[model samples]
Target: MTTTTTWALARVLRDRDASLYLAGVVVSGFGTSALWLASGVWVKDLTGSDGLAALCMLAMWAPTLAGPFLGTLTDRTRRKPLLIGTNLLLAALLLTLFTVDSPDRLWLLFAVLFVYGAAGVVHDAAESALVAGAVPAPLLGDFNGLRMTATEGMKLLAPLAGAGLYAAYGGASVALLDAVTFVVATGLYACLRVRESRPEPRAGGRRKQTAEGARFLWAHPGLRPLVLAGGTTMLFAGLSGAMVYAVIDGLGRAPAYAGVLYAVQGAGSVVIGLASGPALRRLGERRFAAYGIALTAAAAGLRAIPSDPVALVCSAAIGAGLPCVLIAALTAVQRETPDALLGRTAATANSLVFTPNVVGLAAGAALVELLDVRLVSAVIGLAWLVTAVPLFQNPASASRTATRSPSDANPA
Candidate 1:
């Protein structure tokens, strides 16, 4: 690591609030990843239907559609206690899943999973709003990158553990494991030491207030481009994500080979996350995101080459490149939005960014059937390339961000 990024990461690690936040990410992320995989497995075991098994992910992700409304709740509430309470509430909800011993109780599982997704939306919005105040502004990049690393690392380890526990015990054991993690995360969140000052909610009905967040995002020239690019990138990513099996098929490899590709991709994410702070400091936000998207564009086009090594490289490149816009968009949202509107803005940005990913996945699934894999990849790559071009333009707002002192650009 560069001396600058090393120190930046060290600062993030040393700050009490940042450390607590990272710990919460690790603990909660692990449980969520574990439960995500195990729930699908549990469903597959019970119903013996691949379609039903796939619905577990859809169940968890569906509530993101309601993210703006959920986020408004965060804006009006004191975030720390609300965060703690949500974790505790989710824990209690997971405990109730102990009664889910048969396929007949599957409705209960789906319901809990749906609520779990909603909690995630609120928790994320609250965290973005809280962290802006808690962590120093310059270190936000380092903090966010580290958060991404911790999350991706959990994805690597948690699923195997969840699967093992599920095999040895049952689905209930996985729920218990997730519940315990939430309890631990609640304690971690309680331990964060930061002065949170939320501005009073503007006087308006809920609908108008919610609309305000969306309006601010669309109206901010700097934020609007980044958010739109983020959404566009995710849309292409979803299309490519659904092509994994097709990629494997092209390589004449079994479906299991995709797991190896994913692992490499996750490792790439972990590594790039460590460097993102320095990159963002040096490149400025828009350039950093633009470059990452460019790298992803190259990776997408190359994935059609049909070589195993090439595929692995493409996977890692995509992993490393994809987080740029997401972290950039999210960190920008937290930095630029006023604290009063922050929760709603962050959630709305997320909805804008990720909802397209779901759409892309659905679309890619259909597109892959009708077109050749190479052509699809080439088109997707071209699409990402188009998405990236606008971000490189010099905007008035970006000039302001670029002029901060080195200390402000880096970390404290």
Candidate 2:
């Protein structure tokens, strides 16, 4: 809001370690988003079925349903090594696209997409866990804001970029650009100088680490509702996202228009991500979390109304609400959970939260064949809205403290 606040936010990005990681995230994000857009368009062009086009959406995200396993593994390994190795693997996979036609070997596309999703899970979990080690806990909100902004900004641009590249140079050329971006990101991760001060495992921690993380989430009187609401938001968001290609394809619009829509969605995310910190500071995490769910439901409801212009408006609103909910929930975890358990706790929550997305994407695609896409959107929208009612009903929403850092919440 104030110049001082803006200056403070800028300083979070200026930090040497944070800056390098942010740059890598931005480039890698560009690559990921480009691939998603290109692959979705490619699948539709080749298959000539809206259902199949929507299946491509499932291919891109369903593997992430196994995210908890990957998240736990990420916590066990060194961060830089994982990032570098996965980046290289993803790069190679992108390169392989030139040699094989995905249309003929649809299963191959699934395999590649699954690997990409799995790798993405590990990458995100490690990268986020590593941040607490780089920046002070007090500034976690600002740091999270910067990461969200970079990610969403990439989502906004990559679609347009990928579409143009596909039209002129083709999918192979786009894949080549993605491979180069990964290579650069890998190099940047290697060059980041700050060594992670890994948290000491708790006594008998090895056996109980995963269990404790699960128990922590289950026992948290406050977090259960937030997780449920997050899961609901993910479902609707995934459902709505799957329908984007169908909407455009049905109109006989170029895939580039899908990119434009994504860009607009990204613009909305950027605005919300930047403001998330200030909102958390003012609203406290709990009520803000409730508000995020409410906003998401409202956005999804708007989505069911069925007009191109209205769809864009709804998409942007939901896109904006997602970052707010994510930041609130993640910041709450960071504020309430212990340092020793941060990685596992994060893994557990992220996996559960994303599970509905897997279900939602598949269901969204399948539902469209049986019913009107707009009606399906309405059903999913109403479902998300009903699911979030707990956020408002829970008395804890009013009394929860938001400013306490993870260390403050857990003294050891």
Candidate 3:
């Protein structure tokens, strides 16, 4: 890492509030990661229906569609309190999973996951707004990068632990573990100390305020492309995801191969997260994101190959490339938006960027059944390559730069 990146990370660790914020992230992220895998497995084990198991993922993701509207809650309240309350609420909800012992109670599981997804949208919006206040501007990139690292790192370790627990006890055991983590995360959020003035109510009605975030993002010169790039990359990522089973089969491996691929991808993401800050400083957000997309495009093509080693390498490449786009986009939003609008802007951007992935996942899942997997991978790679063309044509050098001063960026 560059000295700037190193120092920025060190500063985040030294600051008490920032440290507490990151601690909450680590604990909650571990629980979320474990639950992500365990939910699908749990549903599958109960019903033995692939479609129903897939619906679990849809349930978790569907609430992001309302992210922009829900995010306005952060703008309406003090973020720290909102963060703590959301965590506690999620913990209480997870406890309800303990009652879901049979297939007949699966409806409860889906309902809880759907609510969990909505709470996640609110929680993420609150956290993003809070971080802009808690950490210095120069350190935002490093803080976000480290946050990504912590989450992805948990992805590497937590699934194994969740699976083991689920195997030995049951899905309810996994849910209990997740609930305990959320309780701990709630305490961590409560410990954070940051100065947040009450937000001034806007003159316009709730409708106008709800739309403000999306309007602002669309109007920004520098941020618009970065956000769009995120959406485009995710669209293709969904396409690639649909081919996971086919890719493993092509490599003459069992279904367990997918787990190995995921672990390798997580390892790659950890390295990329560490390096993203320096990369952003050197390339700026637009070009950095473009480069990451290009890498993802190449990885998509490589994944079309049937070789097992190549498949592993391609998975790692995908992991490394995807996070750069997300982190760069998020850091840019943090650096550019005013604190009062940060929550709404971040949530709106997130919804726009990620909702496509969910749509693509559904679309790709259907498309894969009809099309040849290798051909689908190749076409998806080509589409990502085409998406990068506009990004390359308009580099950050030619665009409006992000606000450099912390006070200017977050005038509260």
Candidate 4:
């Protein structure tokens, strides 16, 4: 690392509250990552039904569709207390899974997963709002980058631990492990010391407050393009993900090859997490996002080829490029939004950005059966390239001064 990059990372780490917040994320994230993969496997083992196992994944994701509505609770409550309570509640809920000893109890598993997902939505919204208040503005990018690194690192490591525990001691043991982490995270949240200003009083009913976030996101010139770019990238990523099986089949490789590609991709994401802060400081969010999209476009186009080495490289490139857009969009939201609306706005943005991937996943699954894999890859690639045109021409990119919001200029 360069001297400057090393110094920037150290600066973020040195902040007491930022360090505690990141620690909470790391502990909680490890368990969540493990449970995410293990839930499907546990269901499959008990029921021997692929459809039921898939439903476990769906149950967890279904709550994201209601993120905007659930996020309003964060705006109404004190954020730190909400975060602490949410984690404790999730830990208690996971304990209920200890009763699932047979296929007849699978309904309980599904119900618990659904509630887990819902709590996650609220917890994330509150955390985003809290971070904007807790961390210094100059270090927000670095904090976000380190946060990504911690989560993605868990993605690489935690599943293995969860699976090993499950295999040796069964699903109940895995739930206990996850529950323990949540308790740890709750402690970390309790340790955080920061002043959280009370949110402004709502002028209207719940219905009106819910829509306020979406409206603000659309109205902000600097945020609008970055968010759009994130959604577009996820759409193509879903389409490309559907083509993975076909690519392996064409290469005359086994299903396990997909795991190799995933590991390579994770490695690339870790590197990007370490470097994104420096890149954001130099290029600004708009240009940083556009360049990342362009790289993803190029990588997606390369997936049309059948070479294994080329495919691995393209997977790494896709991983590196995608997170750049996500971090840029998140940093923009944090910098631009007022404290009063931060919780709702961040939640709404999460819903808008991720909902399209669910759509593309379904669409791509259907289309892949009817279309050629290479042709689908090419089309997704071209679509990403087209999406970048607006970013290149965005009026905010004309001058660095234009990208700073009034809140950023005079932070309270």
Candidate 5:
């Protein structure tokens, strides 16, 4: 079945060289997960204060503040060098993780995390841009589905391997592995050959690329609402991560239980990510996203129901539904926007959504420290539920057919 899916996905890519890009992403994922797993452990080991450990968690979304500018850059530049360059930088940072011994240097970790997060924004923007360039827009839903499945598969496996390496070898060894993966990913990207050409102008031809990209996004009625929905959800989801340790502590579960829950969540994501193409085809992107948002709302409500086996199941459900929301939002952006603006669109979308994520993390951390874990989780969950209301009221459903060339409009 995996083989069949790979072949089908290859056909959609339409270029044999595209496989190298996917392989690069997979290798990058392994490194990313390993670094993440090792970093928190390394920090806590250095500082006995739980508060310090919590601050390190904020690194995930801090760079999101610069997303708009990053998006502008991505739109203006060719993607390949950016992809290769960022991975190289990440490899250097991972190696640096081995040298930090004092808690005071912890601020450096946040700096690294922030930079990494910023680079990640670029990666996502570039990947979307590349994919849009590589395949017809109409087939984006399916291609993205396959990509999501591969990504979730990596998410499921990387942590286990990372955790094991950390236990047996140490943070330095794990860092070494992460560095190696980045190097490998860079090599793979170098091999993939994508045609780089000037992107065509949109309806208004006079504007600069970045300005035009921004103008195009603002002009689209459907896109505005979709961004609102996606951004709001990401903010709350970022908040939820902050509450994980608190939730586990409140439930009297071991720290490892958080891992177990995440594993379950990843399992659910893999199942759905693999089917995202079919789901989009069956329901269309708007409807699929609407249902997904509703599911997320339901899941959020479930988190507030009380901590129990049922609640845990519901928590897992929240993870399961997240990928659907992601797939839908990206599909909408990919379908509605032109190739010239693909990177910027993705970056702007991320910027709009992730800014809240930074706020959400701070809010969640404050709530967990002052209120209690369960309450923080509940409040955030309810807030996420609110984001879904727009989905039900204004379903932005539009099917973008693929264009024959980059010059074509409404390319699927």
Candidate 6:
């Protein structure tokens, strides 16, 4: 790495609050990734049913559907204290997993997992808002990029560790591992030095409070394109992802070969995430996300050619490109929204961007049954290209238009 690049990344780590926040994220991410994989395995082992195992993931993800609602809690309180309290609560809740010794007790496990997921949504919203308040605005892009790197990096290794620990000590051990991380994260959260003010209660009823987040996101011209492109990209990505086995079959490779493709894709994401800070500055969010989508689209189309080497390259490109819209959209959300509405706005934006991924997955599974993999790949690529076209404004112009002062924010 160049000295300049190294110093840029090190700056987040060297700062007091950023480093503590990043450390908390890294610690908890390892535990979260590990437990998610282990939960599925635990159920699979007890019930000997693939469907039951799959439901474990569904249990965790289902709570995100209520994300905008959950986000309002953060806006109504001081985020740092809320962050600390949620961590402690989850730490205690994870301990309840010890009771899941038999198939019959799976309900308890699912209940805890559901709560765990809800907590995650709240934690994420609070963290996003807190980071915006704590980190220097100039460094927000770098901070967010490094956050993705920490998360993606944990995904690469934590599952292996979870699987090993599960094999050695069983499900309860995995739960304990997660619980301990939360406690450590709680401590880290306590050490953060950001000052927070209690937000005044909104005049509306509870339901209206939640709707405000969605309204703000839709009305903002600058954020609308990035978030829409993000959602669209994820949808295409999901469709393309569902065809992984077919892509392998076409190449005459075993299904196990898919791991190699995923690993390369993940590495590509890691590399892109490391450079994303500077890339966002140079290309600006609009062109950055547009080009990333274009790269992803091109790679998806190329995967239909069925060469192993080409598949690897395409996988890396896909992984690298997918995060661009996500990062851009999130950074823009932090920069544009007023603090009073930030938590809900961030949550609403996430729901819009990521929920389509689930829809695309379901649709792609059905499409794969009816269409050729090559045809499916082409359709997704074309759709991605369509999404990118509108987002391809001049970076210089986009930067000027989008870098709005906070005082310009619309009142809720």
Best by lDDT: 1
Instruction: Quantify all predictions' global Cα lDDT against the true fold.
Output: 0.90, 0.73, 0.85, 0.86, 0.71, 0.88
Per-residue error at 307 for model 5, in Å?
Answer: 6.3
Identify the superior model by TM-score, candidate 1 or candidate 5. 1
The top-ranked prediction according to TM-score is: 1
lDDT of 3 by residue, 138-235 (tens): 77777888899999999888888899999998998999989999999888887777877888977677777767787677667677888999998898
For all candidates, the clash counts are 0, 0, 0, 0, 5, 0
Model 6, residue 173: C-alpha shift (Å): 0.8
How far does residue 155 in candidate 5 sit from its true spot (Å)?
Answer: 2.9
Query: Per-residue alpha-carbon lDDT of model 6 for 294-409, expressed as tens digits?
Result: 99999998888878888999999998999998999999999988899899999888888888888888888899889999988987888788889988763223354355443343
Model 4, 1-412: lDDT tens digits are 7887899899898999899989998999999988988899999998899999999878988998998888888998799999999999999999999999899999999999999999999999999988988898878888888888888889999999999988999888889889999999999999999767666687778987877777777767788788888888888888788788888887889998988888888888888888888989998888888888998898988888999999989989988888888999899899988787788889988887887887888888898899898888888898888998888884544255356443343311
TM-score of each: 0.95, 0.81, 0.93, 0.95, 0.82, 0.94
lDDT of each residue in 1-412, candidate 5, tens digit only: 3654555565766655556666777888887877787778877888876666666556866666666567766666678887888889988987776666687777777788778888888888988887777666656776777667678778888877888998898778887898898899989877767878654434533334445445555556567677777777777777776777776776677887877777777777777766677677777766677677767667765665446685578666876677776788788888878766678778877777667767777777777788856566666667777776666665334333232332332312
Query: In candidate 1, what are the lDDT values of residues 178-270, reduced to their tens digit?
Result: 999999999999988866665565676888777767877776767888999999999999999999999999999999998899999999899
**By TM-score, how accurate is candidate 6?**
0.94
In model 3, what lDDT does residue 308 have?
82
Q: In candidate 6, what residue range of length 10 has the lowest lDDT sum?
A: 394-403
Q: Rank the candidates by TM-score, best first.
A: 1, 4, 6, 3, 5, 2
Backbone collision tally, model 1: 0
- Residue 101, candidate 6: Cα error in Å is 1.6
State the displacement of the C-alpha of residue 279, model 1, in Å, after optimal TM-score superposition.
Answer: 0.9
